[model samples]
Target: MVYKMLVLNIDGTLLQDNGRINKMTREAIEFAQSKDIKVILSTSKNFPAAKRVAKTLKVDNHIVSHQGGYIAKELNKPVYVNKIDEKITSEITTFLESFSCQIKLVHEQFSLGNKVKLPENILAKVVFQRTNRFSYSEQYVDNLSEKLQEGPVSPPKIEAAFDNNANLSDAKKAIEEMYDEVTCIEVGDNKLDIVAAGVSKLNGVKYLCEQHGIKRGEVVAIGAGIDDLPLVQWAGLGVAMGNAPAIVRSAANWNTRTNNDNGVAYMVKEHFRKQYKLEFLKKINVLK
Candidate 1:
């Protein structure tokens, strides 16, 4: 079947483990776009971070960010925004402070996080990722709750990283039991992204599809994280990176090479190459 859109996850699916997009992957994305396919980047990162990657790849399409809490094509104009209430934002950050984890209140244009003393190496993991310098700003404080109390904030997402799985699990459960309006998504072993309830990467992409008159059955979704499972399973063509967890791979319609090996490039080339061939055959009246 012919696909109209390609949805991608940024971290482990589009970027290699070292946090760079390979040349082959870049060209392959271009190839798909050349076929008039719309490619959308669906990521758990904030808007600015996702925008930076799109700008780097030269993809100007709308992006799904903040774990599907925000969707925008341009910095100033948001197609959609699902933000946590300012009061709830304050309470959530306040509660999260008790846990042994770093907390970040993610807004559309800025992020306010708590200043937690930790080794440089560990800090790098939480802070050093893709960012758009002009459109996004990040500030750390002695206390996030105090910062919020100074001014109410309706952020699109709240992010946290725990020191261990036990803390992660307990925090997730406690948050769920306490708030009916929010949902905590465990993005990794000990990382969580909290957003409004019913907000998900799948629903975000679905909204985009509806806006563009595309159907769920005419989309290709690729991802590697636990947060990616729903979309990966629901897309017309679901692909898992070789680096994806075993469960994700098993759920996918196809599995490509690891991110380090240019998984995206492999899948895109192989899939579209066949489509191109079929088109050529039909043009020559070789196949109906």
Candidate 2:
């Protein structure tokens, strides 16, 4: 089947382990654009971070960010958004303060996080990963729930990072049990993103597709994290990076090379090449 859209995850699928896009990957994405396939970036990051990557790729389409809580072509105009209610946000932040994790409330433009001391290494890997080179400023306060009390905030997403897996699991379970208005999703190891109930990367993409007149069977999705599993399984061509975990690879229709190995470049080129060859053969009446 012909694919009309390409959904790419930012961290592991597009950027290499070194936090940069490979040259061949950029070229492949350009090639896909030349073929008229709209490339949409879907990430757990806020818009600015995603925009930095989009600007690099010269992608002028809508972006799916905040773990699909926000979708917008530009910062001021949002096609869709599902923000956590201010009251619920306050309650959740208060509840989360009891856990041994760093709490952050993410809006479309900025992030407000609680000041929690963490190891330099873990901070770099978890919090800083999405915040690096971000155009928006991040403010850290002594308390997040108290900050919310100053003013009502309907943040699109809330994040919690834990140093221990046990804490992460416990926090996720507790949040789910306590709050019916939000869904806690495990994005990576010891990291959870809280969004409105029923919000997911797949549903985010689906919402965009509906607005653009696209179909579920006409999309190709690539991802490496557990948060990406729903879209990977739902897309017509679900691709798992070689660097992806075994479970993600097992769910995908195809598995490409590792992020460091130019997985995205390889996958995009191969799929389109086969499409071109099939079209040529059909034109020549070799097989119909």
Candidate 3:
């Protein structure tokens, strides 16, 4: 069957170093639109952050954010949202308290609350590390008092970043034990995300498809993280990045070059080249 649209994850799959969109990638997305292929941005980032990237890509399709818990039209007009239950949030807060972990909760966006203020350098490292293992580091904890002093905001989503090799077995085990009520998703090797049960990238994609009359098989999902596994699995065609984890590569139907290498352009060109060729063949047969 012919594909109709493309879905891309931001952080690792679209943006290269320093969260900037490379020139080749930008041109590729524009070319896809020139071919009438709709492009969607599916990311774990909040709507605001995703909107910036979406604007850069000139994409007007549905935006999937919060790992699929929230979907909006044009970043500001939300059509659907799947938030974690309040009780679950309370329980998670209590659970993390024991470990003294500073969690960033995401409601509609990054929830402002008692989160520890991480230095810009540390924040950069956390984004790069993509894990929750850093929560166990003394340095992270040392900044907690300053973070708490800044006050709190209610976040429906909670994220903890820790250094690589931090022992998080206990946290993982605890979360698993409560799996029936909460879902603990690892974003990368070092970051842990706890959202309400049944909220994931797959759920968000499904919601978008239903609202837009797009079928699961008509969409192409591209990603490079553990959180994107479900989306890749659910898409009609799953395209993983060359820099993706081994597991992600194994799961996708095709593996493209790294984002910095213009992977998006390659896939977009391939999709349309095949489509145009097929259309050309069909016209030829009809004329005969």
Residue 53 lDDT (model 3): 79
Q: Which ten contiguous residues of candidate 1 have the minimum total lDDT?
A: 124-133
The list of candidate 2 runs beyond 4 A from truth reads 130-134, 276-288
TM-score of each: 0.92, 0.92, 0.80
| Candidate 1 displacement at residue 222 in angstroms | 0.8
**Could you give candidate 1's per-residue lDDT for residues 132-249 as a string of tens digits?**
5566888889978888878889988998988777988998999999999999888875789999998999999999999988888889999998899999999999999999989899
The 0-to-1 C-alpha lDDT of every candidate, in the order given, reads: 0.87, 0.88, 0.70
Clashing pairs in 1: none
Error of 2 at 165 (Å): 1.6
lDDT of 1 at 192: 90
**Candidates in descending TM-score order:** 1, 2, 3
- Candidate 1: global Cα-lDDT? 0.87
Candidate RMSDs in Å, in order, are 2.8, 3.1, 6.2
Off by over 4 Å in 3: 74-76, 113-124, 128-156, 164-166, 277-288
Query: lDDT of candidate 2?
Result: 0.88
lDDT of 1 at 21: 92
